[model samples]
Structure formats: C-alpha cells, structure tokens
Target: MTSRYTLFLCALILAAFNLRPGITSISPVLQGITRDLGMSSTSASLLTSIPLLCIGFCSLFAGRLAHRYQSEKIITLFIGCIGIATFLRFFTNSPWYLLLTSLLIGAGIGIVSPLISGFIKRYFPTSVAPMIGVYSTSMVVGASISIGMTTPLQHWFHDSWKIGLGFWCVLALIAIPLWYTVIRHPYTAKQETVQTQPASLPLQNKQAWLLTSFVGIVILLFYCFTAWLPAIVEEKGYAASYAGMIGTISMIAQLPATLLLPVLLRVIPGRRFWITFFTLSEIAGLAVLCFTDITPIVASVCLGIGGGGLVSLTLLLPIDKTNSAMEASTWSAMTQAIGYMIGAIGPIVIGLLYDYTGSFVPTLYLLIAVGFVVIVLGWKLTQPESSQLEEQTVYQT
Candidate 1:
C-alpha cells in the first residue's frame, strides 16, 4: 500500500476503535450506576438499550447523509459527538442524564459504522475482508481495554463510576484528529463522492431482509452477553473483580479471530462451514454458562472466538454483496438499522427475565434458540447460489 493509503487505513482503524467502548464500558460499572442512580435492573438496562435503539434508528439515515455530504466529515463530526457525550458522563447524576449520553454515543456509532464499510468498498475494494478484519479487531481492542479498565479506573478514582464511564472520551478525542486527515486530503474527498448515480437502499430485496435478520440475531446475542456477562458471573458466586475479568477476557479473546477470520474465509472452501462452527461455539459457551458451575474461562474463550468470527463475517457481507461505496453504505444501513433495533431487545429482555424470575436461566435459553436461528439464516445467506440470485435481483431492481 502507498503511504497515503496506509495513513487512511490507520485513521479508519483508529475511528473504529472508538465505536464499542461507549457501550462496553457500562457493563463493568453497571452496579455502581444502579446504586448511585437508584435504578432497577430493567431501567438500568435502558442505558445499554437506548443507544442500541438510537443506533438502529439513526443508521437508517447514515447512507443518505453520507451521500449528501462528505463521508469523512460526517464520520469526524459524529466521533466528536461521541466524545462530548462520553465526557458528559463525568457529571451524570440521574438516570435521564446517563440515558441521554447513551443516545448521543449510539447515534455517533450508528452513523460511523456503515460509512466505514463504504470506505472499504470505495478505497480498498480488493481487500475488503482483511480490512474488515482490521476494523473489527480495532473495535475489539477498544472494548477489551475499556471493559478491562472501567472497574479498576472506578476504584482508582475512589469508587467513582463516573470516571470509569467518562474516561473513554479520550478515545474519541484521539480518533477525531486522525480521521480529519482523511478529509484534509482533497483527492481522497473527491474520489469518495464520485458516483454515476446515488445508490438506493435495497428495501424491496428479500435477501437483504435475510441478511438483516441474521445480523439482528447475532448482535442480540453479542450485546446481551456484553451487557450481562459480568453480572451473570457475579450471580454465579464470583467477586465483582472476577466478574469484570470474565467480560474483559471475552473481549480480549476476540482480537485474534477478528484479525484472522477474514483471512481464513479467503482461504477456506466454504463460508457456511465457518459460520456453523462459530455459531456452535457460541451455543456451547452459553450452554456451559447455563447448565454447569464450571469455571467460565472456557466459556469466555469460546464466546470471544465465536463472536469475533461471526461479527467479522457479518461486517464483510455488506461489502461483498454490493458494488459501490454508496451501495455498500446503503446496504449496511439497511442491515444495521433493522438489525440493531432487534438487537436492542437482548439486554432489556435479559434484564426483565432476571428481574421477574430472579434467575438468568430463561435468558440463556432464549439466546441458545436465537443462536440456532442465526445458523439457519447464515447458512442460507452465504450459499453461493443464493448470493448470485440475490445480486441479480438487487441490480435488476
């Protein structure tokens, strides 16, 4: 790669790094937030869900916004919004305030997510899979660091959860400048905006809906695990520190898969095989958590590997299925918009199930069922015949 291309790649990865910390940081310090704000489990879950909701809703418009404006500018602006929202958490004294910050943070992440896919399609079309691996790996890095550090940061700040939650703003601040350089290069900006015709979202495509549903189920599993794993481990008799470590371990474990899975897909003969393999890994992890009191280390490793692989594939599909930056952006928007809305339910339902039954077993059972559904959808969607037929249908429309 050229030096300029290398710089843009660095910027893209840095920006991706900012996306997950806002959400992941909350889980480790959730108990403190509940104790401080006097909120119950279901209400506290809104902290995670509300942003997911915003992500779903805001994502619907990300493509249109990028089509009308510079993608880099839109990305930089939202990253700044994320920074501002995260910084405000330092002053959070009420549930409403915390929820509002979550909304802004989610909105920022929602808009940035698909545009990054578009960037890959536009700039590195030949390397979409590996670039997505790098992108997704950066997100895992951010999540691992934030989840791993939040509780310790809280302790260091004399038990101030606000500091733990708010400290991640530094990531956004770090990303903005690096991303701004992409816009400052006039040639890159010019190339990004050139399109023979604006790409319309595939609202009428059946395969798009299949992709959306597949994205939804997996994300639902992911967010639920991220939001509740710490508490679930704690309920299983681990100390708070150990519980946080479990979550961090899972996030950290994703790193290798995120970097390697896409490369493996290029070398492997069948996509469905990998999908089934990873989906089964997730189910096994959940089953272990549900049925046995065994140490969670094995489960964490299984989940991290499975989640990392699955998410890398999902992120790749939009680019693989589309022809242009704008098309990829719109396709990504459609999948993530509806997908994240569905995902937003995972955390809330888990919280409600726990509150009502005083147990997490029902929630675990629900995720296992969802995992099976994902396997079927993933198998259908990645089939070569299905992909060819869907591409013809989408282009003809």
Candidate 2:
C-alpha cells in the first residue's frame, strides 16, 4: 500500500477504537454512577440504552449527511461531539445531566458508524472483509480496555467514578486529528460528484429487513452482555472490581472471533453454518447462566465468542450484498437504525426484568430465546456470488 493509503487505514482503525469506549466504559463504573447520582438500576440502564436509541435515530440520517458534505469532515465533527460529551461526564451531578451526555455521544457514534462502512467500501473495496475484521476487532478491543480499566481508574482516583468515566474523552480527542488528515486530501474529485445523490434506502425489501432484524438480534445480544455482565457477576458475591474483570475477560475473549470471522467468511461465505455454531455457543452460555452452577466467567467466554462471531457477520452482511460505497452506506444506515433501536432494548429490559424478579435468571432465559431466534433468522443468510442490490426494488427513500 502507498503511504496515503496506509495513513487512511490507520485512521480507520483508530476511529473505530473510539466507537465503543464511550458506551462500554459505563458498565464497569455503573454502580458508582448509580450510587453517586442516587439512581435506580432501571434508570442507570438508560445510560447505555439511550445512546443506542439515539444511534438508531441518528443512523437514519447518516446517508443524507454523508451525501451532503465531505464524509471525513462530518465524521471528524461528530468525533469531536463524542469527546465533548465524554468530557462533560466529569461534571455530571444529576442523572439527567449524564443522560444528556449519553444522547450526544450516541448521536455522534450513530452517524460515524455507517459512514465508516462506506469508507471501507470506498477505499478498500477489495479488502472489505479483512478491514471489517480490523474494524470489529478494534471495537471489541476498545470495550475490553474500557471495561477492564475503568474500575481500576476509579480506584486510582481515590474511588471517584467521574474521573474514570471522563477518561475516555482522550480517545476521541486523539482520533480527531488523525481523521482530519484524511480530509485534507480527497480520494478523487469524481467520487464526490457521483455521491451527490445516491440511491434511496431499502426499506421495502424483504432481504433488507431480514438483514436488519439479524443485525438487531445480534446487537441486542452484544449490548446485553456489555451492559450487564459486570453486574451479573457482582450479584454472585464477587467484589465490584472482580466483576468488572469478568466483563473485561468476556470482551477479551471476543478478539479471536473478531479477527478470525473475516478470514472464515472468505473460506465459508455462506452464513448458515457460522450462525448455527455461534448461536449455539450463545445458547450454551445463557443456559449456563440460567441453570448451571458454573462460574460466570465460563459463560462469559462462550457468550464472547458467540456474540463476537455473530456481530462480525452482521457488520459484513450489508457490505456483502451492496455493490458500492453509497449503496453500502444506505443499507448500513437502514440496518443500523432498526438494529440499534432493537439493541437499545437489551439493557433496559434486562434491568427491568432484574428489578421486577429480584434475579437475573429470567433475563438469562429471555436472552437464550433471543439467541435461538437469531439462529432461525440467520438460516437464510447465505452470501451470493452476485449482488442482491437489484432485488431491493420495493421502497425508496
């Protein structure tokens, strides 16, 4: 690769690294936030879900935004938004204040998500799978680092969670300058002209919705683990710090699957076999949590591998089916909108179910059922040798 291409590649990975720390960092420090703000578990859960909801809402407009302006510029602007939101967390004295920050962070992340997919398609068309592997792995790495370190940071700051929560702002701040460098040089002037008005979103296509639902279900499974794994372990009599480590371990376990899924996709492009295997792993993890007396760590490993592989697959689906960067963005935006909206339900539902039943057992059962549904939904998701873009002729815009 040329030097410019190398820079853009590094920029992509760094930008992705910023994506999850804002959300996952909260999990390790959730108890401290609830205690400090005098909020209930249900209320605290919103810190994670509200961003997801905003991601879903903001995702609808990502294509329009990217088409209207320089995508790199828009991305840099939003990365700044995320940094500002994370910085504001240091001053959060009320639940509402913290929630407002979550809204900003989510909006920023939502817009960035689809645009990055387009960028991967635009700049690295031949290498989308491997680049996506890098992308998804960066996200998981971000989650692992944030979940693993936030509690320790809290302890280092004399048990102040605000410092821990606000620390991630540095990541966004760091990403801004590097991404801005990409904006200084355009890929091609013709590329900009072509994107002036790309095709409308694929809302009416059966395949699109199926892809959306699969994205939603896998995301729901992921955020559930991201939001609750720490607390679930803590409830089993472990110290808060140890529970946070469990969550970290789960995220760490995902790295292998994230890095491997792209290679596997090249060898086995069809989704059926991978889906069945990953979802079975998920079912086993949830079953352990629901019925067995095994350590939650074991369950975390299984869930991590399962959730990791499935989510990586979902990220690739829209790209695989669409033909161009703009088309990928449109499909990605639609899928992310519905997908994240559905994902938003995971944390809140688990929190409410736990609050209602005074136990996480029922929630684990619900997640297992959701896992089975994913397997069923994924049964038809075989990647074809040709683009399915022409098949999505139902609705536009």
Best by lDDT: 1
Candidate 1 lDDT tens digits, 127-194 = 77778888999999999999999898999999999999999999988888888878997334335547
* Per-candidate TM-score against the hidden true structure: 0.95, 0.94
lDDT of each: 0.87, 0.85
What is residue 103's positional error in candidate 2, in angstroms? Answer: 0.6
What digit string (tens of lDDT, one per residue) describes model 2 on residues 283-351?
998888778778888988998999889888788789878888888989999999999999999999999
Worst 10 residues of 1 by lDDT: 388-397
Candidate 2, position 166, lDDT: 92
RMSD of each: 3.3, 4.0
Give the poorly placed runs of model 1, Cα more than 4 Å off. Answer: 186-193, 389-397
